[model samples]
Target: MRSFYGVVACLLLLQALLGANARAETDTAAAPPAEVLTLHEAQRRAIEGYPSLKAVGERVLQAGARVRQARSAWLPQVEASWTGSHTDLSDVDVESARRGARSALAASGATAGLPSTSVTGSIIRLRNLAGGAAALGGIPESVDSYRVSLGASYLLFNGFGRKHTTAVAKYGDRETRAARDEATRLLLQAVAQSYHAVQLFRERIRIAEADIAFNARLLKEAKLRNEAGAASLSEVLNFEVRSRAAEAALNNARNDYANARTALSVLMNMEDGTLPENVEVETLGVETEEQMSLPDGEAALQTAMASRPDLMRSQWAVKRAGATVGQRRAALYPSVAAFASRDASQGGNSRFGEDDFSTTVGLNVSYDIFTGGRNRAQIAEAKHAQKEAEYQEDEAALGVVSDVRQAVEDLSTAQKQLVLQRDNARYVEKNRDLVAQEYAAGQTSLALLNQSQRDLVEAEGNLALARVSLLAAWHTLRTATGETVKDWPLD
Candidate 1:
């Protein structure tokens, strides 16, 4: 009966183990795949969804509208109008005729005439005129008049103001476009920096994890040695302290990783202001010396001057300002316009008959003889603005040169540091392995083993940092030379 119970217990344990294994497999199968975020992908997302870039794009549209508005001046303007009015002549016509007859008789002096025939003839003529006037006055009590007209006017000349205004608008449009591109360039640079930072911090976390694992293994071995009296209590204590410190470092690294991810999310315009845990940045690859080679400084400077968006924007600004000066100068000359109109009119009705139609055409010339010196003042202001824009262009050019030179220098430094760090890390790692084995064999002290481990960790961290720095420097150089903008066309 006891043997049967033992066999039943063994069967129950086997069933439980099989069930646990099945559950483990199910959980593993249910885990989601990590989402990979490459540096290029980050930049692409930022360009697509970033708010400031969209705002600048709106400015480009506004500039385009202004260009159309300025061009509209070159077209003819046409309009149609209708007017109707009724005037009451209830007593005015009769009273006006009576007053006119009295004035004519008083001024003629027919009674003082030298001959009877002359006096008779003059009185007869005045009576006939009075009768005609009285008959015309009784014809209507009110009169209605209606007029319909279509008119067109074309500007013949405006002292080239239209030309210059259109030029200014076009240049402004170009300037706005360049500004948009410049905004995009800056945004891409920001995204690349944040993306690299996330990668850097992630690498640090891995390093910390490795440190923890190494210390844990050593501590376990030391504890085992202590139990056998092959290692001192202090040796075990030392490894325990190291393991706790590694944990602290891991925590710090994790916090840094979170912060870096948050920064990258903001740049990407993510709603939550952080990347998900399932999202992982692509690891940076090892770089070769040839891949890290520097470009010719002079060639880089030339490229920057030609390709930089800010520099292009400044150039456009100068052109726009010059056009504005011409636009202001236009007011010094006379303006000429040609106007034509066709009209129809009817009296006593709203009807506009063909017989009532009339056509008129004429030219108008206007000159501002004096404008309180306003025109000159405006021209002077425009000239000053032009000069300001030129100065700004010069400043922008200088800035581009400075950025290119600095970026080149930084790239050179990063390349050298990466090479040194790679070699140092390899040597340190070998030294750590040797010291660890020596300490196990009781040929080295615990302090030496501890020092070697710390050195190896430091060396690995420096190597990772160097790799990120070199990559960052390369991107910085591309940005400085405007290659980044060229590579990622907004269109």
Candidate 2:
């Protein structure tokens, strides 16, 4: 009997432990997911995935290609030419020269007024072919004398066209990079703003949820009071209506959160719910008050103008356009290049005998006297484009100024509104509590009690919105000021 009691006790203890373990797990699983994300994380992800950076990378590659093209102008350009002519030109010397090469080679150095090579027959042929056309393998009727020549030319000078063109290419790369940075700034700002909006709506939903729970409690109290003949049926019905409105508000808030999260994922190029799942909008990190510091207005504006990537891009664009003007103007000047050529030829006077050889070297110069005013028209177009770019740069500066001023104003206003809204919410919450106590003691009407609760919930919701607005405004100001990293303004 004693052993039987011990076994029963052991079984009961085991059952109790299992029940406690199950309850713990059930409670844990039933709790809501944790929330932890900050506006900065959203901005960071946006910059990493922004597409404009791709275009800038392409621009860098293009610039490198141009650099290679420009440098190639400095390298010797090699060319080859071969002639098989049966033409009966009045000036026979052209063909005669080709024939000369074959004759010079077959007749040996003696024909070209050079020493014989019986002692150096192999060496003699080298000297003969080196003599030129006839020695190379040409003839008087050199129709069969093949002439092979390697010619080269290099630009000795141009109105600094290649030099300036290279500079322009490099600057074009810089400009593209700046444009990409500007794109990044805009994207980051947008991400920050949108995420802030999501947080705002979520907090509104929280407020609404709290209001709904309170209303449900009020509703239960009203129903109980009506049953006890202390409250009217209409009071319970009115509380139910309030609860329904709160539910609707919570549903709308949830939809807004989902939309905002979807947008963020797309911007970051992430899985639709992956980033959002990892991010908890409710527990966003904020910069401490001690970390926050305000910038001087004039100084900030100046820094914005100096540091804004858009402005720098515009400035470089002006330079690029100016370089184009120089490039076009350069076309008017005559090109001066130095060239040299060496060749070999071999052919028979008839068809199979070597009687061909020749040698010659001379300077060749060329210039385009006219081209239907094409160069003039091109220069005129370039000047106009340069002017356009210059004006565009000026306009870009003005736009920057406007953006900076507006962001500053928005940040200032939102900060004030946030403070006021927070104060208003606190006061209304206290008023609601006081009214609830008075209503229970029969010192306040049901209508007054209901009105106080509604006002307090509205105040809380508005306060949440104000907080979001303030955060967005802070981001806008910092972005406009060209500040990528700064102490957070709201704690």
Candidate 3:
């Protein structure tokens, strides 16, 4: 059995080690490597590799891509298009088109030459060639048409809508990046909490093992007394019951350890259900009195508002919405577009190599003089959205302030608790030793010794909890400050 108090538990510290001789360390001139991961390193790996953070990273990339695609609109648009149609004219209103064409020709006073012999020859040649040899081969007057054109249109002007849209997209990109950082912070906080839980279980296992070893030796001593007729069978039975309970506790600790390992694996972005073998946990360190100090509530509130990422994102969202409003207002103005195109078609439809070519360049100006109240309604809607975004930004800022104040209070209380708990554990341990001595002298009952033992165990557990809470206190402060836990050791 191991000693208690200064080192209370005979823990299964090297519990998961592979086979090795106990003498392996002494024969080596070179020292064996210390492979234990410190708390800071564990927290680092958890935040840096976490899958939740990675998923958020993908979102950031996706939003950035939207910004890039929107910016692409500012570059010149280019396209090559080919269209071909062969129509069977059963559904065609040929008479209507002929009438429309004739009416159009008469209005233009161009049909005076339409019935002339030379005009007839020209019309027949144009129609026959365009309609294809099938038209001349008694194939009912169907039209075979092919058109190939390379065309492009750029918004020479759009009331500055593209500029605003580009601005909005840029803000959206920043919002996504901020969101990713926020996710990383939250994930790290969760990992730290769960990791501390695993450590608690580890300490429990250690305590249980120590109890088991102690009971085993105590049982032997009791047996020796029973053989000499100095102790009863009931005494052995009592020890056996405690031993069994200790075994159950150890099993529970092992189970908790396994689950905790799974949790850490997720935070480290390992494959699903990954658990490391032979991993070591560093012991919890003592906390300082000054670490418990708290500043004025108003300053803490301001710190949260100024540092929170969500608040920053809300501000960006408002800016983006305002930009959208500006973009909509810009849409109410005229847009200018300039275009130049060349066309040539031969051999029924090969517009590519044909010798014929024509080029035209001109400016087009388009403005909506009046549209059934659409533009006015759109501008109103954008303004309303901007107003809503402003409200959200304010709400987010207030929420950040409230959350930080709460975290500060929680951390301060936890720090004080850690100090008191440590002191309590030390006293309880001494009390348990005194009770054991009394039981040995037959001056105290077995029940009293047992109760003292339970008290000591409970005190140790509480101290471990307090240590874990101190770790969480730091995390809470960092989270409230919008400092990414991954970036923590700031400075």
Q: Estimate each model's TM-score.
A: 0.83, 0.75, 0.76
Top lDDT model: 1
Q: Count the backbone clashes (under 3 Å) in each candidate.
A: 0, 34, 0
Residue 351 lDDT (model 3): 46
Winner of 1 and 2 under TM-score: 1
Consecutive 10-residue window with the lowest summed lDDT within model 2: 348-357
TM match of model 2 to true structure = 0.75
> 1-491 in candidate 3: lDDT tens per residue?
33553253324434323224445555453555546755567778876676666678788888989899889869877777666777667635665555555554444344333465786676765554444433333434466677666767677988998898899899888888767666766776777777787788888888788778867776787789889997789878878887888899889988998888788767766666564564666776656556666656677677667767788788888888988898888869998887766655433454465456556667889999989999989999999999999999989987887788788888878878987998999999999889878866778887887788778878887887787777777777777877653365321
For model 3 the TM-score comes to 0.76
For 1-491, candidate 2 gives per-residue lDDT tens digits of 99999999999999999999999999879876765766666666566665664565566677668767767776778887766545443457766665666565566645546555575766756665576543345333324445666688777667667767776787787787677677677777777777787787778778888989999998999899999999988888999898999899889888887888777767766755445454665543453452234446788799899888799899999998988888877776666777777655664333322334343444545566789988899889989998999999999999989988888777777777877998999999999999999988889898898899989988998888777776677778878877763332110
lDDT of 2: 0.75
| Candidate 1 residue-wise lDDT at 486 | 88
Badly placed stretches (over 4 Å) of model 1 are 1-21, 82-147, 344-351
Model 2, position 382, has a per-residue lDDT of 86
RMSD of each: 6.0, 10.0, 9.7
